[model samples]
Target: MNLTIDEIQDFKGKYPKQIWSLFFSEMWERFCFYGMRGMLVFFMISQLNFHEKEANLQYGATQAFVYAFTFVGGLFADKILGFRKSLFWGGLLMIVGSLILATNPHDFFFLGIAFTVVGTGFFKPNISSMVGQLYKPNDSRADAGFSLFYAGINLGALLGGYLCIAIGKGEIFSSIISESMRWNVAFGLAAFVMVISLINFVFTQRSLGTIGLQPGHPESELQSAPMPKWKEYGVYILSLIFIPIIMKMVSVPEYTDYFMLTVGPLTLIYLFYEMSKVTAAERKKLWAALVFILFSILFWGIYEQSGGSLSIFAAKNLNKDLLGLDPNGVNNSGGAFFIIFLAPLLGLLWIWMSKRKIEPNTIIKFGLGFIFLGLGYYVLFATRLFADLQGITSLNFFTIALLVITLGELCLSPIGLSIMTKLSTKNLQGMMMGMWFLASAYGQYVAGIIGASLVSTNENASNYDALITYTEGYKQLAIYAIIAGVVLILISPLVKKLMQGVK
Candidate 1:
C-alpha cells in the first residue's frame, strides 16, 4: 500500500496537494462556523434580552436556514459557479458577515444573520463534495481521507471552543476588556480565521485541477455525456426572496415551522426532478440515500444538543466555575479539548481497519454510532440518580457526558460524508448532498423547538418558576433521544439491505 516515488511524482505539479490542502481549508472555515455557533444562543438570551423560549427558537431558525440553503449551494456549485468559485464567494460573504456579527449594535443582528445565511449556502456542501473529488473511483483511501477531513473540522471546532469562545468568555471572569469587546472578540476571531481560509484556498486553487467543475465542459470533464444541476438552485434562490411573505401568510405560532413548510416542498420537488433523471440501479442508491437521510435526522436531532439543550445544561447545572472558570463564561471549552484528541485517534482507527480490508459497512457503523450516542446520554441519565436535578451539580458530570457524546460523534459524523459520496449517482450527487444537509437543518430546527420546551415558561408563572418548568422538558428529551437511538439500531438491518451493497 505504500506509494512509490514514481507514483507520487505523477500527482506532483498536476495538482500538488489535493486532500490535505482542502482538509485545512475546510478546517478553518469550520472554526469560524462552530466558534460563532457556540456562542449564538447564550448571546441571544443574555445580550439581546430575548426570553429563553424566544431566543432558542430564533437560534433554531437561524441554524436551520443556514443549512437548508446548502441545498441551493450544492446545486449552484454543480451547475453554475463550480465548487472552487462557489467556495471562494461563500468565504468572502462570510467574512463580511463576520464583520457585521462582531458589532454589538442591535441593527446588525438580523443583517449579520442574513449575510451568513447566503454565505453558508455557498460554503458547506461544496467543500465536502470536493473532498470526494480527491480520490479515484474505488480508491480505498477515500473514506479515510474524509475521516481526516472530519478531524480537521473538529480541530477547528475545538480551537474555537477553547480559544475563541473562552477568550470572549473573559468578561464573565475579568473586567480587563470593556463589555464592548466581549461579544466582538469571538466574531473578530472568526473574521481572522476565515481570512486565513480564504488566502489558503485562493493560493491552492490551482492544485485542485478539475475537481470541482460545473456540470458541462467536455468528455474530459468525466463521461462523454451531458450534465445539469443548478436550475433548481436558481429557482430556490428566487423562491427565497419570497419566503418572508410566505412566512407571514402561514400565520403559525412558530414562524420557523412556517418557513420550513415553504422550503420543505421545494426540497422535495428538487429531489423528484433529480430522481426523474436516474437509472434503476442509481435510483436504488437514492433510496439508500433516503434511508440515510431519515436516520440522519434522528442522529442530528440528538447530537445537535451541543448547541442547545446541552449548552444550557452546562450553564445552569454543570460546574461552570470549576477550577476558577466562571459560570457565565463563553468558551464552553474543555469538552472540545477532549474532542481534539479523540477525533484523530478514531480517524487512524478507521484507516487502520481499511488497510486490513476490515471496513465495517456504512449502516452497521451508523447503528453502532447510535448505540454510542445513547450510551453517552444515558450516562447523564444515570447521574440524575446520584445528583439532584433541582440543585446545582458538579461540572464533572457534564464533562464526562460530553466526552462520551463526542466519541459517539466521532463514529457517525465523519462517516456520514463518506457515505453521501459513495451513495450518490453522479448526476444527483449535489442534490443528495443538499438533502443530507437538510436533515441537519431540520434537526437544528427541532433542537431549537425542543430546547424551548426545556426552558419555556407559562405566562402566569413567575420567571424562576417557568425556568424550572422548562428544564424538566430537557430531562424528557434526554430520555427521548436515548430511546430513539435504540430504535434506529433496530431498523439498521432494513436500511443496510436498501443500500444494495454500497458498502
Candidate 2:
C-alpha cells in the first residue's frame, strides 16, 4: 500500500489519504491556537486588569506578530529547513509557550504569547504549503481538497473556541477546578492538544514520501548535496534569539505599528525581486495573486471584528442565555460551527457548477465574498434595533450575522489558499503562502485600530453608550465592504486577464 508522491497526487477519489493525516494534525493545532485566541481579550480584561481598548490593541499586536512571522518562517523553509522540520520545530515551541502560560498566566502573559507568535510563524505556513504540494499544478480537484482542509481548521476552531472560553470563564468545570485556577487549566489544555498534534504528525509523516524533505537532503527530488549542518543550526539559533525581541515588540502597540509598516514593503520588494527572475507568464500569475492578497487584507479586517470589538460587545451588550451558555462562547465558535456544515456543501456546489460550465471565476467569487461580508456587518449593526433598555441585544441577530459572515469566508479563504499554490512557481510557493498570511497580519493590525477607536473613552460609559458606539462602527464597516466588493467586481476583467488563464 506504499504510495509515491505522484501516486498520492493522482489517487482516485475526492481527496488523498494523506489529507486525512494533515487534517487531523491541523485540527488539533487549531484547537490549541483558537483556544488561546478566544481567551486573550477576556483574559487580559479580567485577569491582567487591562482596559478594553488596551486589550484589543494587545490582541492585535500579538496576532499580527503571529502572522507576520509566517513570512519569515516560509522564507526560511524555502531556503533551508523545508516544511517538515519547520512544522516540528514550531509545534515544540507552541507547546512550550502554552505550558508557560499554564504555569502563571497573570505574570508571564506576554512572555508566553511571544513564544506562540514565533511558533505559529514557523508552523502555520509550512503545513499549508505541504498541502499544496499534494496536488498537481492545475488539478481541478485542488479547490475541493482545500475546502475540505479549511473545514478541518474550523472543526478545531469550533471546539477550542467554545471550550477554552467556557473553561477560562469558569462557565464549565466549576466543580472540579477553583475559579482562580481555571485560566491555567485552559492554557494547559492548549499545550496538551499541541502535544497530540505533534505526535500525530510524527507518526503519519512517513506517508508523505519525499514531499517535505529538506531541499538538499539525499532522498530529496532536487538531487543536491546535503545542506550544511551550520545552516540548519543557524535557523534554530536565530529563532531562539528573536524570542525576547518579539516579546518586546508585542508588548508595545507602537512598536508593532512600526514593524508592520516596514515589513510589508520589504516583503513586496523581495517578491518583486523574485518575480523579476520568473517568466512573463508566471509573473502575470504572481501579480494576480498579489491582487487577491491585497483585497484579502480588507476582507479579513472587517470579518475579524468578531474576535476584537465584537468579543467585548458579546460579553457586555448581548444576552448571555444563548442556549444557556456565554454569548462570548457563541461569538467565538459560531462562524466555525457554520463553516463545518457549509464547506462541504459549497465544495460540492463548486463541483456541480464546474460540470455545467456555470461556475463563477475566482475573481467573481472574491467580489461576492465582500458583498456577503458587507451584508453580514449590516446584520450586526441591525442588532442595535433589537436591544432592550439595558442595551442587551437578541442572540438570534448575532447568530444570523455569523452565518452570513461564514458564507463570505467560504468564498475567499480556501480559494485564496488554492490560488496561491496555482499561481506561484513551485520554488516560491512557500513564500507566497507566507505573503497571503502576512496580509492577514495587516488585517489584524487594522482591525485592532478600528476596535480601539470604537470603544467609549469614558471609564463610566454605559452599556447603552457602548452599544451605540459599536453599532455605528459596524455600519461604517458595512459601507466600506460594499464599496470594495463593487470595485472588485467592476475590475474583475483586468484581474482575470492578469491571471493568464488560471481559474
| The candidate that achieves the highest TM-score relative to the unseen native structure | 2
Local distance difference test, candidate 2 = 0.91
Q: At residue 356, what lDDT does model 1 achieve? A: 90
Residue 409 error, candidate 2, Å: 0.6
- Each prediction's TM-score against the native? 0.85, 0.98
lDDT of 2 by residue, 270-299 (tens): 999999999999999999999999999999
Q: Please, what is the whole-model Cα lDDT of each candidate in the order they appear?
A: 0.68, 0.91
Instruction: Give candidate 1 misplaced runs (Cα > 4 Å).
Output: 1-17, 171-176, 216-220, 223-253, 321-323, 326-335, 354-358, 383-390, 456-475
Cα RMSD to the true fold for all candidates = 4.8, 1.1
- In terms of lDDT, the best-performing candidate is 2
Off by over 4 Å in 2: none
RMSD of 2: 1.1
- In model 2, the clashing pairs are none
Measured by TM-score, how close is model 1 to the native structure? 0.85
User: Model 1 RMSD to the real structure?
Assistant: 4.8
Encode model 1's per-residue lDDT on 299-394: one tens digit a residue: 777777677755665566545535755433323545456656776677667667877979776776776677677766666655544345454555
